[model samples]
Target: MTSRNWLTTLAAAALFPMLAHAASEQQLPSEEGQLTVSTVADGLRNPWALAFLPGEQGMLVTERPGNLRVVNAEGKVGPPISGVPKVWAEGQGGLLDVVLSPDFKRDRTVYLSYAEEGEDGKAGTTVGRGQLSQDLARLENFNVIFRQAPKLSEGNHFGSRLVFDREGFLFIALGENNQRPTAQDLDKLQGKIVRILPDGQVPKDNPFFGKTDVRPEIWSFGHRNQQGAALNPWTGKLWTHEHGPRGGDEINIPEPGKNYGWPVATHGINYSMLPIPEAKGKHVDGMVDPHHVWEKSPGISGMAFYDNPRFKAWDHSLFIGALVPQELIRLQLDGDRIVHEERLLGELKARIRDVRVGPDGYVYVLTDAKDGALFKIGLSGG
Candidate 1:
């Protein structure tokens, strides 16, 4: 192993005693059957998100400290890829989500969301796209596609998760920058899910396209810090989740021009345990209710849907990573409703950051820590 990998291995071992041995594997019993948790790669510094590359190219991972690298199928982490944009890299900010273009095979395009520095010490979430070089070592021709307006100075609450709908429209989930009232603002991109064309152009049919007062890219509004997003294959709609203050994390199927309640209709109170200033009640007249709400916040982060045929018990399930509770949550789905909920990996006690269903039909997760690691879950004997 290289020197950096060796150091990371030692760090992971020190942080996670269960992974004391290099290449350790653990078998745990679950409702679906016996499952095996295997370490894929280690020594990632607060790893934020991951995306599986097409075919044999392995995976691309983004570290919160503003580094991006590739990890091979054999679990060897490569050097940091070049040409990453400058990031704010402050508390709860940095290089965030990464995804490939829908036509990656033909276009070689990669999309990234991050905290970017703006004028006079202010910063906000930004989205950009670049083409991957043939060797996968650099991002070529990168350019900013969108930048959140009226940047704030706070270092937290950059809600950034990128997804492409079935029709190939790019949807970006953003946060309110800890500015509570911005969630209700019509002119700013904060606290809203915005849809745009691949090249950063607003779609002519967008809800506010013809309106001069509102930001035309908005698809839906009134959200907190959304860290997870995915396209629901069954419904052809975008599903997203966000962090509430102390409780009340929620999931919503965002629709065009609709207003989902944030500060004005939250089940959660301030972090100080006081009621929110603007909230009138838990339910409001004109606001769209969450599809599902967790009364006790799980500190939810990344999310993915499982529709693979390899595991019958796991199919049609939604896997979400929880940070504060340190577990992977499996929500059994009956169409749009969550019928049952199962918690996985609480014994590990690691802050689960991002969850994704691999192309190989296994569930993969990133642990958020100074010495984080990549883990894969599969059938015990598979």
Candidate 2:
């Protein structure tokens, strides 16, 4: 066998001795049976997000330290690509997410979100678009498309997740920047979901357009640090997950012009263990309730709608990565509601940072660690 195959076989043998016995006995699950997990790529530094190319030859992955690497199907990591913008690189800051444009095959354009340093020593989440060079080893035409206005000094809460809807509109999730009162403010983009054209212009039809009280880009407000956001492929609804203080992590269905109770109303307490008054009722009138809430936070990170057919049973379900719980949580959806949730791969003992369905219909996971790894979940046998 080739060296690469030999190495992979050796690694698999060492990591999962159970595979050997099962393979000999032909006792592996069929295509629709129990899930098997295997490491695909390794030796990464705090890998954050992954985006599959159109043909699935490889994927682009982001590292929190501002590096991007291409991992091929064989689990080989390429040299870091150049032309990434400078980032603040402080606590919970630095490189965040990488996503392909809706027309990636035609345009070769990619979008990135990071915590950028401002002139006055402040840092805020910024989104930029760039084209992959002909050789695919570098980036060109890099330009900042969107930046948080009136950047704040605090680095604690930059939401920085990007997703595109069926209408080709871009939505960016922004946090309160560790300023509790800002969640209630309508003038700033902080603590709000902003909708814009792919090129970053505020859509005139936006809910607050021409309104003096709210920022023109604001679609919804009152969010904490919404680290995870995705477009539900089945319903085209925007779903998001935000980190709460001591407890009360939330999963919300975001709607335009609506307010999601953050500090003003939450099921959670402050980091100091103090209580914030709940919204007048358990479910407020103007605000939306999470489809589900985590009373004990698991430090949720990235989320995506499972669109691949390989796992037919998982269609329309939402997969979220948990940092503290160190597992991948799958929430089954039944007509815009979560019917069930199953936590997978918790025994692997890795902090999952992001989850994506590969073009091949396999589930790919990016783990958070100093020497992080990319893992693939698939059926062992058929």
Residue pairs that clash (backbone atoms under 3 angstroms), model 2: none
lDDT digits (tens) for residues 1-382 of candidate 1: 4566456545533433332222668887787778788898999999999998876678899999999999876788899999999999998889999999999999999999999988778789999999989899999999999999989847989999999988999999999999988999999988999999999999999999989889999999999999999999899889999999989999999989999999899989998999999898779999999999999999999999987654567879999999999999999999998999999988788999999987566788999999999998877633
Q: Estimate each model's TM-score.
A: 0.93, 0.89
Q: Which candidate is the best by lDDT?
A: 1
Off by over 4 Å in 1: 1-22
TM-score of model 2 vs. true structure: 0.89
Per-candidate Cα lDDT values, in order, are 0.89, 0.81
Candidate 2 lDDT over 235-341, as tens digits, reads 88898999987788899998889888877777777677766654343466667777689889989998988875445677777889988988888888888878888
Model 1: weakest 10-residue lDDT segment is: 13-22
Clashes of each: 0, 0
For model 1, what is the error of residue 39's alpha carbon versus the real structure, in angstroms, after optimal superposition?
0.1
lDDT of 1: 0.89
